[model samples]
Target chain A: SQTIHQWPATLVQPVGSPLSLECTVEGTSNPNLYWYRQAAGRGLQLLFYSVGIGQISSEVPQNLSASRPQDRQFILSSKKLLLSDSGFYLCAWSEASAVYEQYFGPGTRLTVT
Target chain B: AQSVSQHNHHVILSEAASLELGCNYSYGGTVNLFWYVQYPGQHLQLLLKYFSGDPLVKGIKGFEAEFIKSKFSFNLRKPSVQWSDTAEYFCALSTLVNFNKFYFGSGTKLNVKP
Candidate 1:
């Protein structure tokens, strides 16, 4: 069984604050990682995806960036958060053999004030 | 870029009613289709997927979807939906050209009254 973990489950930050969200997957190796954001009344948007360590692709360039430091660990970071960055952040992992069969982790609700 | 479209934005139905949600995709190449469900305040869960072969694909919890190649449609269906079936359903598309990118629909909110 594969399990994905993400934290902090919720966050409240003032404008210009730095943001860091972590995601880890257990029981799988060499998996593809992805970061997605869901805004209010909008569908999920693909922010970034990583095929392997040190390989990241940005789908929608913005204030946020993603890093795959380890095979099973992925991190989303922002130097300075913007008001528009407030949304639900999700981390997903899929087997390399099947990219679209991705599974999601419990999302982090970010609130920027 | 490929795109997915879900016909129903919101649907309210009583328990035991039949369920059918429309999904259509626009892409030039061969594609993979999926249906994911998200309960309130929860992350998305894969309900089913269609890769190749068998236009009709059965998924978890008595849910099924048919992929119509000519129409580019993959509509999800369930015979008797329970109250627990209340959730938002999303249709996704993944093409071979851009396998890493998955396009999602806006989603259809299903509310089943007990």
Candidate 2:
């Protein structure tokens, strides 16, 4: 079975600080990876998605960026974080053949102060 | 642009009661629909999905959804919802070719009482 791992499970970052959230998938190769952020009591907003290594698509323009450094490793990063960046970030993966059904990781809750 | 709409923002029901959550999409093309559930402090899980063939799809936790093309609606239903069923439900749609791009609804929160 495939599993998606994301860390740190919870993060507290000061404003204007750098941000880096990593996601890795085991037991699957060449999977589609996605990053999503959910505001408090709100719907999730798609930030970025990667089809393959070095290929990333931005769904919404914001303070975040994504990279697929390896086939199973995806990272979400920001040079400088904003207060609006505080939310629950989720990393999801799906097989290339079955990209419609995505599997999500435990998620990272970031609190910007 | 493609968009999904979930009618109920929140619903409260007692255990053993029937469950029906409305979902609608505004896209006139070959599309796939899905229902996802997010339990408290848990990641989103696939409740059910409709690609092609059958209009009705059954998913985990004894949940099912029916797709009506004419109505552009996919409504989730459960005969008997338990207390554990209390969670946030989201409706999603994706294009056949670009399956990686999924549009999600605002989600509905369901609370089932004992």
Candidate 3:
């Protein structure tokens, strides 16, 4: 079975501070990784998605960026955080071999002050 | 652009009451539909999905959704809902080719009173 892990389950960051949220998938290789942000009482907004290493497609223009360093490791980063960046950040993965079903991680709650 | 619409933002129902959540997508080409449930303080879980074949798709926890191609709708139904079934349900749409990129609706929050 494949499992997705996200860290710093909760985070508090100051404005203009750097942000880094990690997501790693176990038992899967070359998976499609995605980053999404869910504001309170709003639908999820896809921030970025990566198909392979060093290949990232951004869905929306925002303060965040994504990178896939390894086949199973994806990272969401920001050089300077904005107040609007505060939200529940989610990490999800789908199989690369025509696996369209996405499995979500626990998510990271980041509050920018 | 591909998009999804969930009509009801919130719904309240007593236990044993039936449920019908409306979902509509705006994509004329080949597409896939899915419903995901997110319980309070939990991650999103796949309730059901419609790829092809069956127009009526049954999901876990006695939930079912029917896909109406003509209407471009996938409505979720539950004959009898329980308090434990109270959760936020999200309707999603994706292109058949670019499956990884999912477009989600605003979501419907269901509150089933015990």
**Model 2 DockQ, alpha carbons vs. true complex:** 0.68
Model 3 score (lDDT): 0.93
Q: Candidate 1's residue-wise lDDT over B1-114, tens digit each?
A: 688888789999999999999999999789999999999877799999999999999999999999999999999999999999999999998888778888889899999999
Candidate 3: which stretches are off by over 4 Å? none
Candidate 2 lDDT over B23-102, as tens digits, reads 99999899999999999988899998999999999999999999999999999999999999999999999997678988
Error of 1 at B51 (Å): 0.6
Fnat, 2 decimals, each candidate: 0.62, 0.57, 0.68
lDDT of 2 at B27: 94
Which pairs, if any, clash in model 3? none
| Candidate 1: tens digits of C-alpha lDDT, residues A1-113 | 99999999999999999999999999988999999997654678899999999999999879999899999999999999999999999999999876858899999999999
Model 2: lDDT to the true structure? 0.92
Q: Candidate 2 falls in which docking quality class?
A: medium
Candidate 2, residue B47: the lDDT equals 90
- State the C-alpha lDDT per candidate: 0.92, 0.92, 0.93
Model 1 TM-score (2 dp): 0.96
